[model samples]
Target: MSETTLDTRTVPHDMDAEMAALGGMLLTPSAAADVAELLNAADFYRPAHQTIYRAAAALMDRGDPVDAISVNAELDKLGEINRVGGAPYLHTLAASIPTAANAAYYARIVADKALLRRLVETGTRVAQIGYTGEGEAAALVEDAQAEMMAITSGAEPEEDAFFRSFMPQVVAGIEDRANADTNLVGLPTGLNDLDELTRGFRPGQLITVGARPSLGKSTLALDMVRAASVNAEDPAPAAFFSLEMGRNELGERLLSAQARVAFTRIQAGTVDDADWARMAEAMPRINAAPVAVRDDVNDLRIIRSVCRRMKATTGLRLVVVDYLQLVETGERSENRQQDVSAVSGALKAMAKELGVTVIALSQLNRGPESRDDKKPRMSELRESGSIEQDSDMVILLHRDDFYDQESVRAGEADLFVVKHRNGPTATLTAAFQGHYARFMDMARG
Candidate 1:
């Protein structure tokens, strides 16, 4: 078709009317999702674009004036909006929309956005208006069309398909890093070797730290949680889901661990000057870390809900469930073993689903008691069915003293890696100070 004919046919007789219709069409909840999907697929923008748009919207919502140049500059300042190729795309973006999540968020003050909703009511009309027979306008319209198509296609970006296939690998990496950052909020245990071995309890790994009651399972987890939160090269925010202990009790334990006072001593409140001095030295660091504890939730659903809420607020990277048995799985089957399996499996799956590492403290079966050595094995993890299958790593806590005093007086506890699915299986030793709930490296065990 000739340019004139194409122009007449393509650009509606009333340009304003056509733009209005397209805007209305793209804004519907479903339509908006479709529009977002298409744009994401056709061209890639830095993940920070989402951040920039959200920031811009917040500014606009507060009636702040952010002209295109100023907005782009602000994004550059915050490292949100980076280099854009050619021209006005960045400028156009600032002018056209505000963003909440997947949709083009617009201020209600922009009367056109309300109108845009109506225009996007039907795919046929959007296709016609956006296709622009042939030009820059056509390109923009096509992107909008693609976004609509993506939404209509009923695909979730976070689902495996979109994350693995459509989104850039960088997004996955960024997400992983963010997840890690959120999970490592507690202090580091100053065990360099252990930190190097596991990258400070990574995101999306269900690590079962199980052993007999006195073998330091909770101590090890708390120490690692505290250490990881504080001593990370890049710290990840963390939430401790201590089903067995109340928040106050957990806090006291942490304070004791930091203060180097025996947990019993702290409880007894017989603090000497030295213990008080040590606590003064440690409490500030312990208190300032980005660690949070949750003990109120017990039901599996409630636990998951609490976890999700934590993820929302703190960008949780790691979750420590203090002793798995304490979690009431609520899967009322005849077999408690089966019930335990479901709970363990759900924890592992949660690690993968939320992309957060879960260091789950677990109680050992009488298997440890039966064994002469009493060091835990993979099979020794109580409810091995799901815990064994779901865990990426399993470290069984075993104090020789729990079995024999020579081990504790020797300052030795074995962290037996019974299952290292991604790595090697070996045993390492850390000095367990039960009094303070702290674990120091054995250095030479």
Candidate 2:
């Protein structure tokens, strides 16, 4: 074919497959259910096929008979009988296939063609956007990626495994855990008590760590990242999306924490011989760890896109969004609460979609300061009700010395697991080594 002819070719479709699928549905009720599970009316390329499929689906949904006669009458009632070639065409479809057992297979072919058509449409739209240069380059790229992701995600088969199908895997997992040396079922945080209480952070969980200003919520989250990526017996890839702090600042904090060097000394460029030695010893591990840090982008869509790419490339295990309030969804809402709600919901969805544990640091309201005990609570999560609703777990952080300098628990911090959806809620204490810019388990300290 010539280039012009190829360019002008009709979009992908398999009319035979559409007819076969519809014929199978007309032959048997089970075939109709099977086809419906894999495809909808839009998957048919022909308008007549679309109308016929819709009529049959409507009849099936109402528990009515789904034969050629019933479908023809239904289409006629909806004034679409002539549009779909009347009763004779319905008979042609019923005679098109020999057996209904292959209905799902035929539906699969139709669905695949529909997916390709969607892909072509998405490419056309993206090309138009590129031609127009209507938005920022980064935003446009993100929008294009979002469009492609939507098509691929929609094409994925629905998970319809029976309960019995899951028991074997569950038993295998139990046996594996029983045989393993560690008790952790998910990625571990370095803080031993918190890890024990939360059973580490499981996949598809949105764990919110909330604290007031200067209480070291960022420090705590970074410590978890270090644990998962750098300190574990078998370290996993991790990502840190720092919206409130710069990359350099985060690097300094991570280095100081890992080396047990003073953060102030690192900040002032006054590291002495001992600090230099510790940092040198820690450098190799930090460099080898598959940890990605991005300090520039705050848009949630871009962040999610980067994360999805990372998950595909490096097998990302944990994601840390340093404080949730600063994340922008790239769309303005009527109120700040709504914006935060959208951001949190997207973060939760990203965690599930990527199958990674997400530790989103959150800023707490002033509820702690007003209380006599100075302990943060779940209700104090800044900006939105959805934070608590969306999160699988919520940890509230508090430090004694932060409130009273001479208190007995001077260097101790309390992490209250206020909302653990899968486990009991409790408070755990850790050593807040502020100078080192990290938290340590009390026993280790």
Residue range 177-260, candidate 2, lDDT tens digits: 899888899999898887788778999999999999989999999999899899888898888999888999999999999999
User: Number of clashes in model 2?
Assistant: 0
lDDT of 1 by residue, 1-445 (tens): 5233222223113323222222322233332322322222112123334354444444433434434555566666666564442125554443343332323222221234323433444455556555565557867676667667753464555555655575677687667768774333223435655555654555678888888776667767777777677555656678788777788877888888777788888888898999899989988787767788887776776666556545544456778888787778766677778777878888988887677888888888887777687656677677656888888888887777766766535567777778877667777777777767788876564
Model 2 error, position 209 (Å): 0.1
Candidate 2, poorest ten consecutive residues by summed lDDT: 1-10
The candidate maximizing TM-score is 2
Best-matching candidate per lDDT: 2
Cα error, residue 31 of model 2, in Å, equals 37
Q: Rate residue 5 of model 1 by lDDT.
A: 25
Q: How much is 357 displaced in model 2, in angstroms? A: 0.2
- TM-score for each prediction? 0.60, 0.67
